[model samples]
Target: MAKKVVPEAERRRRRPTRTGTVLSEGIIVDTALRMLREHGSGGLTARRLGAALGADPSTLYRYFAGMDDLTRAIGDELMGRALAGWRPTGDWRTDLRSLGLAVHASYLAHPQAAVLTASRVTGRPREIAVDETILGILRGAGLSDPAAVHAYHAFIDQSLAFAALDAGSLALTDEARAVDEEMWQSTYALLPAETHPHIAATAHLLARRMPHSAYPAVLEMLLDHVATRIGGGGGGEETPHG
Candidate 1:
């Protein structure tokens, strides 16, 4: 006897419901990420996400305890993307430069999300792994435990701080961004020559510099400071010097 074959649509309709427990957390996070990228932090409420996903808001609770929990998960997702396939090259400067640029690029790609979540310390697995990688880099550079820890703190803090700040600045609407440019060109550029001689001298250069132009240079300056402190040149013999 020939067995009846279910139609594809019928099969889909009759398929057993996904155990909520095993439902794709990744999908949830991805949706949240998209919401963040499109709407900024304020637009990421559970109800909106639920509507977007065709799931009840309560369904989100099964995956995350609350919006804060979900936000942290989103942060972890971003970190995972930033660090994916990242392997240290054993050159501290190059490794750090790569890491900083990767992070900045990742955050810039999701500026609203970055602005919302950059300061959060979720201690999620991926975040912990990033911290470990950074600490290892500093330690491999021959920094003492205390110095390595300090440098790790400074490096991570500065990276995230700048990434968030830069992302926020980039997220401004075209009109708002144009206004900022206008202020710099018209108002800031016109500072009194005698009272703000240094500012006056660099106003044109500053106005011409795009936001991205300074990130690499800023990262280099920070790394240079870290290297100086690690190389025994900054303070005393305990410090490392280039």
Candidate 2:
């Protein structure tokens, strides 16, 4: 199916606001992200968005079908950032690691927004391209069709799942987030040795490392599985150098 291009060009020609602010998809999305950051997801209403954009709520509908559509576009923008300047290195493991880190970083960069949209299937250009790229990399690595597809599924899903989990923690209110951090240090690290010997033994290490993201570790594990399945330490063959 042919995908509809976001009407960015058309949106650029949209009428100027009462405050003389030019309205475009970029401006709207930027404003929306800022609003999301400042006010949390619940505060990103169409009415509020319009006020921030210096236009009526209905005016936004001219560009976005509605809030859901606008949200997907915002999500796509994050995907676009992840893919930006990313070129496969033809070494599948290295490339996938780079790509996975890019994705993980992109979501962490916008924790609030990521919490809202990390699991979404936007069907936008960047999202579609990313899926194709991951699948292509798996196939290019010499996996059979089923193996490549299955690996692709595990890789993408795991990446997003970790992103969402990490982002959710980061998105919590400061007090709540601090509680989580405290729990790692004060609670987990203080478990009784006789009751939970393993956790007690690793308490100090867990307190220190638990605050960090596990996405990289998880990504490497997934890649290791893929490598084993493909009959190589990494991909069976290097991706063709461009």
Q: What is the TM-score of each predicted model, taking all chains together?
A: 0.83, 0.88
Residue pairs with backbone atoms closer than 3 Å in model 2 (clashes): none
Q: Show model 1 residue runs off by greater than 4 Å.
A: 1-22, 210-213, 233-242
lDDT of 1: 0.77
The TM-score of predicted model 1 comes to 0.83
In the order shown, the candidates' Cα RMSDs to the true structure are 8.9, 5.3
C-alpha lDDT of all candidate models, in order: 0.77, 0.83
User: Alpha carbon lDDT of residue 178, candidate 1?
Assistant: 83
Native-to-model Cα distance after best TM-score fit, residue 221 in candidate 2, in Å:
0.5
